[model samples]
Target: MDRKKAAILALSLLTIISTDTVAPLVKQISASYPQVSSTMVKLTITLPSLLMIFFGLIAGQLVKVISKKAILAIGLVLYSIGGIAAGWSESFPGHLILRGLVGAGTGLISPIITSLIADYYQGKERADMVGYTFAISHFAAVITPPLAAYLGAEDWRKAFIIFSIVPLVFLFTMIFLPGTARRVQSDAAEKRKAPIPTKAIQFALIALVMMIIFFIVITDLPYLIETKTGISPIVSAFGLSTCTLGATIAGLTFSQIYVRLKKWAIPTSLLACGLGFLLITFSGTSVLILGGLLCIGMGIGILISLIMLVTANSAGEADSTAAVALVNGGFSIGIFISPFFYANLPRIELGLPAVEFNFLLAGVLFAAAGVIALLVAISTNKQLNLPHR
Candidate 1:
């Protein structure tokens, strides 16, 4: 409710705005550019993700030399310009170039937002802020894609107009976020700094896998719904939105969930995702598919927040930004690789339809991962001599 929290939430709203808004417009954009390959056209959605990994690490280092607010401002400006201009581009290459700029901007912005939360809040309050950040981001995700699909119905370029909202977030950042000085560390201070925790690295890897699974819903569900049920793509888009709606619900309630689940939260979330995917695998109707996606979204939403919180807490303040960036970079990598990874699976050999096989594989993977996480938690609790919750 405070200006600082508001500013943070406003920035959170932009995190998914850059890439997701363009997703529904991909087919239209490809159609408009008859000369370009479908692979290149698809990059309109994934290119930003590839660039995010590169620039996200750069951002982690930038925080050491510049104020986070200043970095954020620069990123916002790039995102606004690149995202808006891409819509107007006449050439396919030009559009891809602009999208890369948007990705760079997002890369810089994403790590800083989580690092800022770590810098500004602590303990349960920090956990709550992380939850709100996920909640706000998913809420934006739920709203933006449908709006973009509607706008791009006639002209795909118009969907880029969604990025025009970046200026409003920029204004909030400039007005409400208090500026901090560069994080200059002396040789002695640097020596005293602990190495990034192994747990943080492990969690970053978990984040990578989680995004790979979660993006199955994002990148594949619309196609699945349309092909399976012969529904309009707009309805497919809405079906996708239900996934984010579920995530939004999870984000809003994560604090209480964490309070009750503690370390058990990770496995519980993975199990929820597995069950959701299983529902999608077996369900025959569009409405049932949407319900499955909602469940998947809730599980992924909580899983990501838990990863961010645990990773942040694992490192010293000086190293937190870099640690957070690693996890975010993992997320971007997962996003970039998901479509190809799923598309190339040996589904043909298995004698199943692509969409059905994808969901079935996802369900099995999530369930296996959940059991692994439960074992890890049990082992960790034993090592710490802690009571099982």
Candidate 2:
């Protein structure tokens, strides 16, 4: 509500842009480094994701030892350096390592974004702030991919330069974020005793599933368009931007949606995801694919916000950061695994050129996940409504 909180939220959104910065450059990087296989090129996108899987949890634990602000400062430094150096690196191996550093840096900051909000805000304000963060993330996505594509069109290295601005974001955060670090003392008995809630665990699992479903589309969309439709990266950028637009809409309207749907919010989101994937899988042209991707983005937009809200609300304040870290880590794991799943799986004999069998499978999986989420929502609703004997 105040300048400080607003600053933290804005700075936190900067971190969101980092996650997808390299996506548009994937094709160019692959072309630039022909020595590596396509799969290895894809790893450039997922490698940082893999590090986030471990570092997210490590960050949670590290918060007990160091200030979240300090960790974030360090992360921004790594992120800026990695992003800047990546543009200059000639060796493929060196580029990969820089990518990993960027991921590690992101891992440190990602968990704290929501946790800081949870720590600072409460009740309706907390929920609204959470939605705002998702909206900010989507808005950043809308800007970032297209810009990366434009720059990458000239030279893939140009895309990495965008990451250098992150240090400016760090400066703003240091100046504006309030100094309120929680340091747990060495006395075991006096330590914070909050337990991770069951709902948080469930949300973490849901985050994992949703992330896999969401990122498969993200990681594959550009390549799929280039390989199938013979479109340029700019066109692919537009399609992805359309998807982010859908997410932006969802993020902006999340409060109304959450108020209306309540406990069914996540299930409704999951259904949207399923529908989106279906549209994408069966789409005949890039326009139709954009439509499908929009649907997918809307689902993810709502799902991600709701999951963060649930995870943050479930934990007591003492454990909020750790709870967030666990969920982030789960999402990271999903991100790490998505590329591999698509790469290694044998193509289906679906007679459809340019249509991946994996997309079809992904559609089915999303639909099934939606159904399961719906059933679980109903069951949980019933349990909550039951009278005491």
Highest TM-score, which number?
1
Candidate 1: worst 10 consecutive residues by lDDT?
Answer: 380-389
Candidate 2 lDDT tens digits, 132-195: 8788877887888888888877888887778867878888888888676433345634344666
Q: Tens digits of per-residue lDDT for model 1 on 266-363?
A: 88889889988998777777676777888888999888887887777777546577788888888988888878888777655676678878988899
Each candidate structure's TM-score, on Cα atoms with residue i matched to residue i, is 0.92, 0.90
Candidate 2 lDDT (Cα, whole model)? 0.76
Provide the overall lDDT of each model, using Cα atoms, as 2-decimal numbers.
Answer: 0.81, 0.76
What are the RMSDs of all candidates, in order? 3.1, 3.6
Residue 85 miss distance in model 2 (angstroms): 1.3
Candidate 2: segments with Cα more than 4 A from true spot: 181-195, 227-235, 346-348, 353-355, 375-389
Off by over 4 Å in 1: 181-188, 191-194, 230-234, 348-350, 375-389
Model 1 scores a C-alpha lDDT of 0.81
Give the lDDT of residue 241 in candidate 2: 78
Clashes of 2: 0
